[model samples]
Target: MISRAEKSANYLILVVFAVFAITPILTVLQAAFGPSDAGGGGGFGNFADAWRIGHFGTYLRMSLAVSVSVVVVSVLLSILSGFAFGVMRFRGSGPLFYLFLLGIMMPSEAIVVPLYFDLRSLGLTDTFWAVALPQVAQSVAFGTFWMRAYFRSSSRALVEAARLDGASTRRLLWQILVPLARPAIVTMTVLVFMWTWNEFLIPLVMVTDENLRTAPLGLAFFQGQYTQGFTLLAAGAVIVATPVVVLYLFLQRHFIAGMLEGAVRE
Candidate 1:
């Protein structure tokens, strides 16, 4: 049904957008591998130098710990809440679910000031919980929305069958529904992990200790100190971004499937 002109136009549009998106990344790659004034090194050597000079080893560990913690806590809470909202209706459930959606609509920047003051009051400033807790809350909002869509559209026959088999609510969820929700859960996990890993505003405001600095936060300070060192800056950017890239690559299939399913169902 499509004309050759339409196909060509589509390809052309895609090519243009691809170049637009890739240009900055390619520029960074070039800067990372190109010669620098700090030293004669290029390529991987630049990464090593950046890693050493930036203390990214500590940053990487801190980021992983915070991100992983956020993902685990957020995903679990989202799943439980999603199951409740989607399958087990109760009093005032609609209002409560809407409250959760408000979280998704709220901007982090809007809350950063209040969040910092609250954390300071609790004496959680400069601590891992300071970064992880807010991110967990944000991620759970989206995850609940995502998983609730999945559960709402899931097979009612299977749920009824589980009930007839005398499966308790917790057992039914974990032993039956959880396995079938793998694609959706994996997709949610990947997304939450990415968000938590890339989050900057919360970590920047909450923690001041160098040892607790996440990769992105550390990269910001590293850029400040090495403003003239383009090669090192580029290399540090690559280092900070690589884990997210690798994670997406590994989980792309599930993520795509889950997204398509969510789209069709919604």
Candidate 2:
């Protein structure tokens, strides 16, 4: 049914967009491997030098810790709360759901100053919890909204059949519907992981200790203090971005399937 001309046009558009998307990354890679501004080594040697000087090993581990903690806590809480709001009807539920939405609506910039003071008063600043807790809160807000939508759009006949088979609410949610919602869950997980991994501001405002600094924040300090050249800086950027890229690639199929399923469902 499709004409060859239209198909060719679509391919042309995709090729153009792909090139546009890939050019910057290719440029970064070239710079990352090019000569150092200090007039010395190049190639993968720059990455080695940058890694040694930047302390990326420490920063990356801290980032991994923060991102993992945020993702796990956010996903768990979001599932529980989303199930409650989506599948169960209760008093004041409407108002409570809106309260959760406030998290998505609110910008971190609006509250970071006061949030810092609150965490400091609680003696949580300059610690791992300080960097992670805020991000967890932010992720949970969006996660709940995302999970709630998936659960609400779920198959009612399947849920009814599960209930009739004597499945408890928890079992129905965890065992039945949750498995069917894999794509949606994976999509949300990828999003939360990416956001938490790339988050810079909360960590910056919450912690001052060098050990507590995450990769992005560390990259900033790495740029300012240790590096005076473009090569090392580019290499550091590549190092910081690698984890997120690897993660997306690992989950690419499920992530894209989920996004497409959601689009078709809506």
Candidate 3:
């Protein structure tokens, strides 16, 4: 239990951080709904103009397509790989596992130039696949590491019992491992969704077609033109931020529990 002073400090910290974090969002909100004329009163006209000019409905669809697909694929693959590496023992496991650990340490910016050429060779450049593939790869490294840690500390007796019941490898994972590992899975899903949704640099470099641009890319363009469009930009920011906020709200407990499990295991 927190003391009164500690609670007060916590609120103070929350307030300060909220202001700091919300300053840009507020600016965008103002631009989105702010005054239309040079020095006129605030109104909803800017949001209307931005909506029409940005083709935001289409961009929202593109963002949903890319982000949802990336999250699903990334979560499924990470669970499979993390469980294999965490629970199963085989030849060359140590070395291969460390290779993945190395990938977690590597920064996306480091190989982005090569990634560009690699995508170009595959003829996926400027497509949703180009962005999705790299983002998935980037997420897998850390997701594997984190999920692996969670699986490592999970109940061994349950795994053994499942094996005794004649469960196959795939069934054990899907039926037993995943159910027990729900907290970690939810945490990884939230984190990956946030990253893939807000990602800008990769999409900025990979996608040239305006129609295929994700929300972040569209916001960048909107900001460039509507330099003073605070209210409209705020509305856009709200739109872009809504999904992740809702995800965190739903998964907050799972996220915290997963983090605690990893910390204890490590």
Candidate 4:
């Protein structure tokens, strides 16, 4: 239905955008692996120095713990809540669903202050839970909305057949729906991992302990201490970002398919 000229124009635009998006990353990579001093050749020394100086080993461990915990808790809660909202009928379901939708509409900046105070009141400040819990809440909100849409749009005939087979409600979800929802689940997991991994503001505000710092927060402090060392800084940035990049690379196909499917349904 499209002309060759239009297709060419679209391709040109996409290529331009891709270059725009990739230029900064390429620049970072160059600086990360480029010459460190006046005569030294490029190598991994900068990364080693950065890692040691920044105490990124501890920061990385903290990040992994929080991110993995948030993803597991958020995904499980999202699945249960999403399934209920999508397929089950109950009193006040519409209102409750709308309440969860409000979470997606709310920005973190708007609630982070109150959230910090509340956590502090509970003596959860300066703890890993301080950083992880709020993010889990936020991720679960979006995940529920995402999975609910997926379930709601699933084939009614398939659900009916499951029911006809005398499958219990739990079995219908886990044995039948869960397998079919693998793409959506994978997509949500990737998204939650990326968000939780990259979070900064919550950790910065809630945790005062140096050991509890996450990668992004640690990178900020590292930058402050090594403001003049561009090579080390670049390497640190790459180290912080590599996990999410690798994750996306591995899940690109499933993520793209899930996104496209969601779009088509919408």
In candidate 2, stretches whose alpha carbon ends up further than 4 angstroms from where it belongs are 1-17, 253-266
Candidate 1 achieves a global lDDT of 0.87
lDDT of 2 at 79: 90
TM of each candidate vs. truth: 0.91, 0.88, 0.83, 0.89
Q: Following a full C-alpha superposition, what root-mean-square deviation does model 2 have from the true structure?
A: 3.3
Candidate 1 clashing pairs, residues 3+ apart or interchain: none
lDDT of 3 at 92: 91
TM-score winner: 1
In candidate 4, stretches whose alpha carbon ends up further than 4 angstroms from where it belongs are 1-16, 38-41, 254-266
Task: Give the TM-score ranking, best first.
Answer: 1, 4, 2, 3
Candidate 3 RMSD to the correct structure: 3.8
- At residue 134, what lDDT does model 1 achieve? 86
Local error of candidate 3 at residue 204 (angstroms): 0.7
lDDT of all predictions, in order shown? 0.87, 0.85, 0.78, 0.86
Candidate 1 residue lDDT tens string, 1-266: 99999999999999999999999999998898887657756778889999999999999999999989998998999999999988887999899989888888788888989989988998989999989988888888888888888888899888999999999999988988889998888888887787788888899999999999999999999999887668999999999999988987888886666556533211
Give candidate 4's TM-score. 0.89
Q: How displaced is residue 265 in candidate 1, in Å?
A: 18
RMSD of 1: 2.8
